[model samples]
Target: MANSEPGLADFTKHLRKWFETRQLSSETDYSEKLWIDIHTLFQVLAKGIDSTNPFSEAVCEPDNPAWTLRSHAAEFKVCQRIVNIFLFMDGLHYVNNGDWQQRYIFNNEQRLEEYLRCMLGHVALLQLYGDNCDHIELVRTVSNSMDPFREAFRHADISKTCANMNYRNIQIGTKLIGLTMARWMEQLKGTRHVGSITSDKPVQICNQGQGTNTKEATADGVRQNGHMPIVEMMEDGTTDVVKKLIKKGKDMTDEVKKRLIETVKDSTNPEKTMEDILDTVSKCTAPGNACVQSALESVHTSVTPVPPNPADHDPSAISASA
Candidate 1:
């Protein structure tokens, strides 16, 4: 049966209360934030649904919970529906800026750095509904890209007298790094995207760091999913996307650094920005075999340039004679 009444999204707030009352977690800040983000995304989608198309009719709600989203058109729709909710919530400012890096969600003083860290990490959870965990890697890779931003937070001069939020906020930094765990697992599921980039160019890669350490040796690097998609298999792999997006007029900034780092963090909370992310990216050295732009550029240049010919000798010309 369809949820005819469309149970109010207040479900998020109530869920948090339930967790809190049982002392499962002290306060439901993380869970409540998810509710807020999902609800916000739903409202946005709801408007589009009412004005143009009804989602309920197009997207089926299957009774099977174990089925992968790819199993059926309806399942994927529902999965994408849930993913869209999170994307809309997290995208409020960056989406408006026309570039992912322009928004400074975390740099301001007088902020809840740790709480925001938790929230960013929680956003990764949005992958749970998908047929692909590549999104998990996508999220983690995005988080790693924002490491420099978190590093900025870690090294940022907080007041000596700033009150502690009951524990050392180092949790935020570790939490940001912990995003790689999801990335590793996400890679197991893999990802795929279809687009055109023959005319695309690589955005100029810059060293935003004044020089700082964000985390211990880890796999993620400065390039958020914005710069490069993780575990890709392109004609040139991650290098191609970076080159294309850059050519498309993408800009780089410290805030972009922050968002990239945050992307790898958890998706438990949908709206919060973690400061340690800036600091972490600033500090951590590239993990084993990590591919930064410079590396990609080197490989791109080393490939023997193919001469243009009218023969069209590759697979395109493979007719019945093949």
Candidate 2:
């Protein structure tokens, strides 16, 4: 069920029109790259959804099956599209300076959110349709696909607003995918024969020598090697944690600096400790912090709003008028 040429063309045309309506197409370089990425994402998703068949090899060997391979590849493609959308949105935000509604067509954020919700829903539905059929491999494939996107988003120098929105969406999508897999595994376990013994089940071991049991042998081996406890063994763990904290602090430094400068200009607080300063900075710089956003909103409302450009029509309104 791979997408045909006409279908692909129609999808691309629709996307192009959407971008054009939003005035995004006015920027030649941005629009060209955006359209290419969108087209690729649409093609990948269409092909993957069409070609996936989780039941093709239902009775094959437990370890590997024809369906597993096809489904895994398809799911990976779906995940790639998810990540592409995020990166594309980040790129758009990087070049544009405005609120979400100002930057894109009306309802664009809602549309993207709906699309992600539907994609996650489709994956859950696919697993449900399999009826307790094992798709652990597919689940693993989808989970692993998220790593690259996570790393990219983690390090991307994007606004807190954009980052928080996309990050929450990605997190939700992955959690849904994981829950679907968990449900599938639960169903599979429920259907298994009562007498079955899984490979993970502990086995009875006879003492071979020195009256040593398996548990005792394991302890003895650890003691002989002078292995520290798990937490203590992680010598670099504390250093890693501190480094992450410092990185987070550095990332917020600009906002913190702005707040500090503002405070100094206003001379609101004459005396404050380092702890108090940090606490104030943390409150001000935290993503989506209610206090900071509320203050900004008040300031924003005090200014006269500029009318939206007539050329930038709302896509939803345009559709309704048509």
lDDT of 1 by residue, 1-322 (tens): 1111222122222332333343322223443443354334333433322121222222223223454546554434433433332332233222322333212232331133322223222322322222233333333433332335335433331111111111111122222222332332233224321111121221221212425222211113413223222222111122233222222212334444343433422223211222223223223345312222222222211122334445322111110000
**Candidate 1 vs. true structure, TM-score:** 0.20
In order, candidate lDDTs are: 0.28, 0.30
Error of 2 at 228 (Å): 38
| Residue 142 lDDT, candidate 2, scale 0-100 | 36
Provide the global lDDT of candidate 2 against the true structure: 0.30
Could you tell me which 10 consecutive residues in candidate 1 have the lowest summed lDDT? Answer: 313-322
Candidate 2: clashing pairs of residues = none
Q: Tell me how far the alpha carbon of residue 123 in candidate 2 is from the true structure, in angstroms, after superposition.
A: 5.4
